[model samples]
Target: MEVKHERVKQCLEAMMDSGQLSVGERLPSEILMAKEFGVSRETFRAAVKMLEQEGRLLVKHGVGTFVIQPLPMIPSSLERLSSIGAMIRTAQLDQGESRIKFTKEGCSPEAASALGIKLGDPVVNMERVHTANGEPVAFSMNTIPQEIAGDAFDHDEFQGKLLQFFEKRLGRKIVTADSEICVPLHIDRHCQRLLLHPQTTVLMLKQVHYDEANRPVLFSRDYLRNDVFTFNIRRTT
Candidate 1:
């Protein structure tokens, strides 16, 4: 049996699956991996590089390689937005939090425009550091217009699901909304602190939630760890 790219990929996957690679854990060097797997150093290096490109791992020029813990999975995505709380819970993960602040304030221009409201309108401006398996994976900014958001001002409910609050608590089920996904230039400090890694790219999801009445209810911006989660766009003919 020869140790090749496939074998290296398998070994790495197994380590992650078994919790041996735990998020942020530095991987053994290529030389060590080659000797351990009975493969040439070049072969091991190539395998490591592939994983890095796939966003399952990271490599520092002079330092070493490290494993990146994946985000909560969605079932065969086809361009539908899923609730973060629901996604986290569905994975059977016990949700954990270290809250900084959850408050109500005036909306920013971007938020106001996204919701199609005036510049200084009252908005439910909320912030939270979302974690998965106790590792911070996203910084969430959720804003809703006070006129339409209606009683969304309740701070306690923000701890739960904002999407659900819009439907059940506020009285409307979302039909469709605009969602944009892209990688941002700078990762926020909160992300760096919570993720415990330096200068990783951030995946930005900017969404406007609309109701069955074709009215906008919520506007949200999520900065996710790019190395862990990816948004797939499904096109229909």
Candidate 2:
């Protein structure tokens, strides 16, 4: 005989397959499900916790349990340079915003190396929180030449589009960007501030955008919330 927890899991799976439950849909009450499935209430609660830890369900503090929205699949095309704004929309989630910090400053060693500039080069640092459907999804830190970003007309123009901000704020068109990624088990200070305890592990994406002349037009480091921003990638090698 299967374990009690497995039985509950099986029942949930059946509901999901039948579409009675869906991504982001709530499950029945523990009491209701226990009675409905003829299981002890204790067993039922255990099952819900198991699934919740597995990232299949979300439990609210004072509310009920709900199905989790699946992570967005990473695109197979790793060659393309996509904006954080463009990527979330591609996944069909509403994009949200919170620009934490934006200022003009001198380039640090890391920034210089990434942007191909000497140390102390003037750079504009743009920091913001990227959101998905009103949920904080990632933290982005972008740096660009002060001259381009300093121009008022361009900065205002690029306000809505981070990539466009490059072109409009600095008069430089982005040709490509290099993005590196990883998943982490621990939460960052900022992540804790966002109030998200990722059921599954979290991932990191660090990138630097460069223009046609290979000048580091923008230096960026983005920490994506693993659950909400799922990515899909298809490849053959």
Q: How high is the CA lDDT of each candidate model? A: 0.73, 0.74
lDDT score, candidate 1, position 211:
89
The stretch of ten residues in a row with the least summed lDDT in candidate 2 is 150-159
The candidate maximizing lDDT is 2
Estimate TM-scores for all models.
0.59, 0.59
lDDT of 2 by residue, 32-93 (tens): 99998898999998888888866678999778899876544556245667777877887788
Off by over 4 Å in 1: 1-78, 89-94, 98-100, 187-195
Task: Predict model 2's lDDT versus the native.
Answer: 0.74
**Regions of model 2 farther than 4 Å from truth:** 1-76, 153-158, 183-187, 193-195, 198-200, 232-234
Local lDDT at 138 for model 2: 75
State the displacement of the C-alpha of residue 158, model 2, in Å, after optimal TM-score superposition: 4.5
Tens digits of per-residue lDDT for model 1, 1-237? 754877988898888889988889998877888898888888888888888866788899899888986555445252566776555555566667735455667879998888888888888777777777878777877887777666646656544666676778788788686888765554555445445576556767788889887878888887777655555554436
